[model samples]
Target: MMMFSWRRRRATRRMARGGGGGSMTELTIPSHFLCPISLDLMKDPVTMSTGITYDRANIETWIEGGNFSCPFTNQPLHTIDSIPNHNIRKMIQAWCVENRAHGIERIPTPRVPASPVQVREILDKIAAAAGREDCEECKSMVEKIKILVQESERNKKCIIANGTGNVLSSAFEAFSKPERFEKRVEILEEILSTMAMIFPLQEEAIKHLKSEASMQALVWFVRGEDKSRRRSSILVLKEIISSYPEKVSELGEIQGVLEGVMKLIKEPICSSSKKASLFITYHAIASSSNQEGFTKAFLQMGLVSLLLETLIDAERSVCERALGVFDGICETKQGREEAYAHALTMPVIVKKILRVSDLATELSVSIVWKLVKHESREDEDEEDGGVKVEALQVGAFQKLLLLLQVGCSEWTKEKATELLKLLNNLHRERLECIDSLDFKDLKRTF
Candidate 1:
């Protein structure tokens, strides 16, 4: 058996050399010189609880990615804490030094890992700097925090766990007044940029910035040219408004806030910015009392055309959100009138019924229902001019039937059925009365 083991290994080696049975030079890297996790020479070697060693950055990344087990052992880790493997690091360094003539580069010493205590100290320094009149110190501290956040996702979690968000919110609240906006624009921008990086902000932190004056400052920030600031501002705003939906009405009262949100919806700068703007718009008109004001502002800003444009090419999620906001606008009499007035409004809405998602389908039906209901009354006053005629001519009724044929929520099916019946009634009335109408004039009007 021993002779067979030796022969088998030798045969494998010979085959690896293209079956030439010739001598081949292959370098074998020392296993001890490499990290167990990365299988690369360790620059900042650290040992885990399972007695296996890995590079520090790789382990931290593993931990941040929600792994709590040793990669090699596959055992549930008692604790993720790791200590520097100084001896192994030194050995790797010496090996690199000895192999310098072979083109290996010396590894630089790794910086000491940040501890919770060190992070706490930095947070205090940032708080102190923010309180001081010197914007330079505050800016410096913000830059340092940004670096720490960029170092590891764990660092971001650490800073957030230690009330960094609250401290930053307080600093922003201090400059919430418009009087200080110009003077503190740079510092405020830095703070906002930092906050944007730490997303899914805790409700507590959002509440700190949800005050009237603080929210006003955020609105002003959203209107800025810096797209990063705008993104951060809108994200924060979306979180806050989502939490306290009742407060959305007051946002419409803020000067330039509605317009700022509308501008984002009109020409989305980024996907995130566009989504944030959609959330803000949806929330603003969510309340019945606020719909009148928002509808007026939206129409004045030409959102009907913008929404139609957005719906045509937006991704499914953005399409759903855009449809939601459009439906909200159409709930009001003014909104319904404006939407019906747009030439492409009903057609675009009809196109989205089953093409997007279930939510989008429902919103489209609701908007059509509103338009149809309003136009039914208008048809009584003027026989030939109504959304029903345009919708029928544009094949909206056929889409409605297709909507019913395909499965949807019970409410959607019921609504579509009702709209179908109304459409059929209108079609029958038109056919019965066709003998009295002029065909040439009908073609011109349509």
Candidate 2:
């Protein structure tokens, strides 16, 4: 009798637990139900199991009214399909029994609250310590703060360092800022002295002096009326040019400043040592190819005649550089006519070019190359009424061709190639000059 009552209690419990497949076999039923669609939980619950389990009249009405679905499948359950005897309900019940008879376990939800009060209190403590300044923690923090600020400032200043800290740029800017001339001059003198001292030690120091700012200062100083500063500036400028041949523009200005420096070189008022220094300065100014000032300076100082005289006694290096400057002067149309006139009247100039060794030969060839390029430009302009080619003298080309034929050095060949290319473009008439000679062969031979 007790066993029968227990079975009845189990059945009652199964009926009380709504919408899930009940365990008829177990006294303790499973906790979860299966959805009709997924055969899992009743995700969207419905009532289409058994007539005794759900409201059969209402479910039948809902299914007929198009509202009822299978609890496991969530599929529309028609009255014909879900009226307990429907074959589809039997299949869903079997699926729910197999898949989810073990039931769905309830999971507890976790809760987390904000900690604003604790965070604010910690921040306030830190702020109070910082404000006290006497706090031991604050002292270390302040040191870190100082370092960060200094680093930021350094980063800001580093941007201008390349331009403002540059010796030449500062010197040039000083020229326009006359109010700062005294300070600039002092810096210039320091830089010049450093340049001179470091030149023999490192070639790069000479390059720094050749920058536009340094060149501008040297040009201004050369033309300035102050004889003492001119003398000093020229001395330093010469030292720079002597070490670095690339700064040839200074030679142009040297011609204008020549007389003053020459006076210093010749005067008994200066010691022999000082005179020699001045002469070296004069030599530096005279040797540059790019500077027109050097030509004017040369003429002003009567250096053309002096250069001719020195051809006999001049050191090989000096002779080579001086001739290079002369060649540079002669390569342009104006320079060519001037040099040709000088060379024609003064056989010494021609002799100097003809008798010069390999170094001098290289310089002479470069000069010829310039002349060739200049002539070619003139030829082009003549076609456009820009200039008259016939107006140009013819002797230069004849001399250049003769030099190319006889010259065998690699430098000569390179210069010849450059000149040939220019001539080929402008004067096809001169192509025969390079037709027989292989530039590669000459390069190999040299």
| Local accuracy of candidate 1 as per-residue lDDT tens digits, 269-369 | 78888998999888777777767777788788888889899998899989989999898888787887778778899778877766667798899998888
TM-score for each candidate, following the candidate numbering = 0.80, 0.33
Alpha-carbon RMSD of each model: 8.6, 31.4
Evaluate model 2: give its TM-score. 0.33
> What lDDT score belongs to each candidate, Candidate 1 first?
0.77, 0.44
Q: How many clashes in each candidate?
A: 0, 21
Candidate 2: worst 10 consecutive residues by lDDT? 106-115
Model 1 C-alpha RMSD vs. true structure (Å) is: 8.6
User: Which stretches of model 1 miss by more than 4 angstroms?
Assistant: 1-30, 33-44, 55-71, 74-76, 86-113, 132-134, 380-385, 426-446
Error of 1 at 414 (Å): 1.7
Candidate 2 residue lDDT tens string, 109-150? 111111334323433443455344223443333233223324
